[model samples]
Target: MSLVEINFDGIVGPSHNYAGLSLGNIASASHKGDTSYPRAAALQGVAKMRGNLARLGVQGFLLPLPRPNHALAEALAYDGTEDRALRAAPWSASSMWTANAATVSPAPDTRDGKCHLTPANLVTMLHRAQEWPDTKRMLEVAFGNGDHFAVHDIAPVTFGDEGAANHMRFCEGHGTAGVEVFVFGRPGGKFPARQHEQSFRLIARRHGLDPARCVFIEQNPAAIEAGAFHNDVVSVANERVLFTHAEAFADQQGAYDAIRAAFPALEVVEVPSDAVSLEEAIRTYLFNAQLLTLPDGSMALIVPEECRESAAVWKYCEAMMASNGPIREVIPVDVRQSMANGGGPACLRLRVVCDPATVDPRFLLDEAKADLLDQVISEHWPEQIDPADLWSEALTTQVVAARTALLAALAITELD
Candidate 1:
């Protein structure tokens, strides 16, 4: 089975300035504390996609960690290294879980917002759990299938003290046998905004992932402007897939161009863009793996009411759809806010695994299946990611299973 493990956020920090304030333990760019509604909605969007994948017989699901800062803090405090080296780890450990509320972090104020430790913990549990039949086996399978590396909007780790330790625990938990970290180190101990393209190639080789199948594509944290990593960059498709986006309507032509050049051999289909803006339409284009043209002529796109007449979107969609075979179905989704924060439906979902075996037979055939599964995936993105063909087959599967058992036990005890 072919799977794509996606990490949200090409760089750390929420991109949308308008996204409600965060209300977790750590403070953020926004005046509002951690656990903001917008952030929750973003996570919800990704979660929704996982549920959709389950229905599609696609075993993959998004493996999401805590917020960027939250995760960064975790790693900083516990990567079994010094503070400087830990901080240099490729990604940050941000999260919406308020450390203050859970007594996880000694924030200046804990009562200011609602907080929960479960989301981040669950993320860790989901990613690291092992074996099938484990309580959260579904979560592990959906998120654990990754060898070759790729990421979406993932932020770099940046924090001190307990915050750092929590993030490290999460990363370490996922750093089991098959999982490979695709992040990179920054100079002077700061996470750079530029795309860490080198990390993609490096991790692919380090983990023994197939370069012919692995891929990492994402928006560079360095520039929310147009032309970040899009214009001219390419990498070998080492046994994995990584794709990221930052509002298409913005200056991201370069980023698009890079992807086009990267996956020269994959089948790409263009569809229609009926969304309100060009960015949303284009983002749909990327996830559908239709950014570039397939051997056929049609293009695949997300059909939204607003983009019915978008010439570029329509033309590409029509071309991809019209290619050798008809274009795949047009998926409708609501991702208006994601664009503001450098994300579209694809960015929000974070695909960790794809169950090729369970996927609809139609996906394997030349024809498209008119079903909600495709729609759900196009909409939520992460709900369908699976970590492996079967959780039992993975090396870390046992660990995850153990963790799941512990969690179930703890839950039962709490209930009593």
Candidate 2:
């Protein structure tokens, strides 16, 4: 059986705004209160999806979670009357970064012969914490094929589950059994490690992964202090290739050795510290680039346009491509709207490896459907959104109407 890894990217929402809600994200904090172009952001995301479908031939899409999170405000007893509550609600369009959506264990690795997914609690950050409920509903509706998929609620909030951003898998192919690596951060640093060790262990156990095939590693404190808020900031993996920076983990050699022990065929590509400093990696979001295995069995790096803009990063990418490495091509995508808010190409997607036939058709995308979605975004999405505009009753109504129209167009009434 041939299995493919499908990238389910989140459609950027009309509520996309730069409220600077992500505390440790340097870009988010630096660009606080800046005006955001929601229409452009959504279109950019759609365009990126189109590029993937056209170039890689394997692309899936997920709708944005309902935003301005009114339920959270009501839970906090703010009643939406005061501007303080409205603003404090975070109105987070952060759901566009679906890497934090869930941790998925494909059928090949699970004991039950069914794909398993656990929605992330995202409890460490206030804005992200509200995502689980809606995220759970979305997953349930999209992956409702009970014979092939199992969706579970997030682990306890105390466990601090940040989802796939802290998880990665490696194997010979998408259909083969793979080793699941869960990277967790300890709480002794200047910046909080959003993923907890307990949470990682709980997820591995819940997924019923074989003990020998599961590995747990710690993220480097220095990296966290230097603004590597999540493991993806420093490392990323696809199939048997692990693309990472030199200072990404606490015990880099040990982590690699452990992975090698489990999967001896693993290929480790470490970009040396001297070539690209951790600061440059974070600034350019080099590790956040999607390392994809193309239809012809070659690999390509789908990176944010910011990578090309950075002199050192772009030079490194060019060298990597020229060196005849595993990555055959470097495709630059324009997601500057998401980049400013601290997300890039990899951040905008969730990877699920399975037979396409097993997933709901509504969740998949093709060139024609992508074109229709792009048209919907262009016609209905708001042009600009300011942090202060989130409280207006008119804006709330507009957001609702836009999402309702999109759901109707997609024939997905469950979310509506």
Candidate 3:
């Protein structure tokens, strides 16, 4: 069976704002209460997707989750008035970073020979905790092929599952069985570890992956303290290549040894501590880049523009590109809006390996669909949204109308 990895990116929502909601996310906190350009943010995300599809020739897209999250306010026993609910509800546009969408086990690894996805419970942060139910609903609609796809519920709340943000898979090819790496964070430092060890184990067991092909590793507390909120902030893997910082994990050597023992051909690319400090890595979001296999059988690093601007990161990337390394080139994408919110190129997407035919047609993207989305974003999305405007009836109407237009264009009736 032929298989390929599709990148499904979440469109930025109309209510995208800087509420400084996430505790561990430095950018979110730093930019709290600042004015946000929701229309520009959505268009920037679309442009990135368009470029990826044009360059890589394969990509997919997911619609933004409904914003203002009035349901959450209602659940909290807030009055049903729109103004009251909007005022009380937390504005969460974090769903644009789809890496936290789910933990996907490809058909080759699962016992049932069907791809499985379990949405992250995301119980650590209140704003994020409200995403799972809507996320699960969207996932079910997008991956509706019952014979080939299995959409599972969110992990138990106590487990604190953060989904693909703390997961990586390595294989010879997308069609083959791969080694799944689950990186959990332990709480003992200044910054709280968002992922729980039990959560990692639970996901592995739930996926039914072979014991020999699964490895669990702990994240380095030092990295977390340096503002690496998610494993993706300091490490990312693609195929057989694992790109990471020197202090990314608690047992760096042990983790490497285990991975090598499982997949002998694995290539471990470690950026030495002296060359790039954890502070620089987090600032440039170097590890948050998308390591992709291009159509020419060579790999490319799709990084945020911030990496190119950082002298240290740019120097390292130039050296890497010059060498005969697995990464043949570096492609910089402008996602400044998302970056300010603590997400980068990799965070914006969820990677799923499958036969394209098995996915729901509405989730897949083409040039025509991209054009339509561009039109929707340009014509209907809000130009700017201040924190104080979150409760405005006019803004709510615009957001709802924009989403309705997008759903219609995508032929996604379930969301409508």
Candidate 4:
């Protein structure tokens, strides 16, 4: 099998709205109560995947998990009596940020030589707590070929696990064994530490990873307090390179030393805090960019437009490109809608290294599939979703119909 990395991005959902659900997510909190454009959000996401398909030649997408989750609403017994946040929880489009969907250990890193994925039992907040079962079901369908893939139930709820947003892997190439870093946080603060240390330990064991190759590190407490909710918000790793802000970890040198001990060929592309402060990185999502190994053996950083708009961030990127470093290209894409919802390019995807043929083709994106997505989203997705509109039965029906239409178009009967 020709093993390669496939980024399974989430197609933004029809119920995309700004309910300001995620705590410690500065963007989400700041945009709460603002009207959101669902059609535009989803289209922007598709456009991103299209760019990925062109660059990598193979792009897969995870469909929006069934939303306006009536089961959750019924379980909460939400009869218009609870707080607005509770009422809006059932309709949140947060699932479109697929980084939190699961944590994956590619075939190269696992003992069984079969790629393993664990759906995150996102028990952090009420809005996201109800997502795992549906997320797991969707994953099972996407990676159902038993011979090459294994999707396991999350090992468990108590210790919070926010999935790939907090995890990074390093290796010489995508097809080789790598060091997996599970970044967890120290609790007791204004904002809750989402990825508990215990949770990642559970995930590491669940994936049957070699303990020697797994490095458990602590995210900088200051970064978390500064609204750097996940490690990806402060750092990102791709193949042999680790691109990071200076203050991304509690013990920056220690983190580097640990990684080097396991993989000696590690390349560090450190962005100085003098050029861009921690506050600037978090605000612009400078580190949340996707560091990809392009098809021709060059590396590119897929950053949000906000990075270009910022003088400091852009200057740093320009210097990095001119320095003859591993990162050869700096490409900026417009994911403004997702960025406003506390997700940049990285948050919209879950990366898996595997043979594309082993995946259910319905999850992969081709030109015709792109066109179909544009049409379905344009026709069935709501043009604008006001915070108050989430309560409308008409909007609920539209959201359900839009997802069903997408499932039908893809011939994904399991999700339907």
TM-score of each: 0.37, 0.97, 0.96, 0.99
Candidates 1 and 3: which is better by lDDT? 3
Clashes of 3: 0
lDDT of 1 by residue, 81-112 (tens): 43322322212212211110011111111122
Off by over 4 Å in 4: none
Error of 1 at 93 (Å): 11
Task: List lDDT for all candidates, in order.
Answer: 0.27, 0.88, 0.87, 0.91
Tens-digit per-residue lDDT, 1-416, candidate 3:
56889999989987888877777788878887788998899889889888889877778988788876777777776564555324534567888899999999998998888898999999887778888888999999989889888999877788888899999999987778999989999887887788988977877788788989998899998888889989999999999999999999999999899888888889988999888889999988999989998888888899999998988899999999999889889999999888888899999999999888888888888888888888998998899888778757998889888888888878898987
* lDDT string, candidate 4, 150-219, tens digits: 9988866878889999999998889988899999899997788899899889888878899999999999
Leading candidate by lDDT? 4
Candidate 1 lDDT at 234 equals 13
For 60-147, candidate 2 gives per-residue lDDT tens digits of 8888778667778777766646454256455788888999999999999999988999999999888889888899999998889898
User: Candidate 2 has which clashing residue pairs, if any?
Assistant: none
lDDT-wise, the better of 2 and 4 is 4
Sort every candidate by TM-score, greatest first: 4, 2, 3, 1
**Which pairs of residues collide in candidate 4?**
none
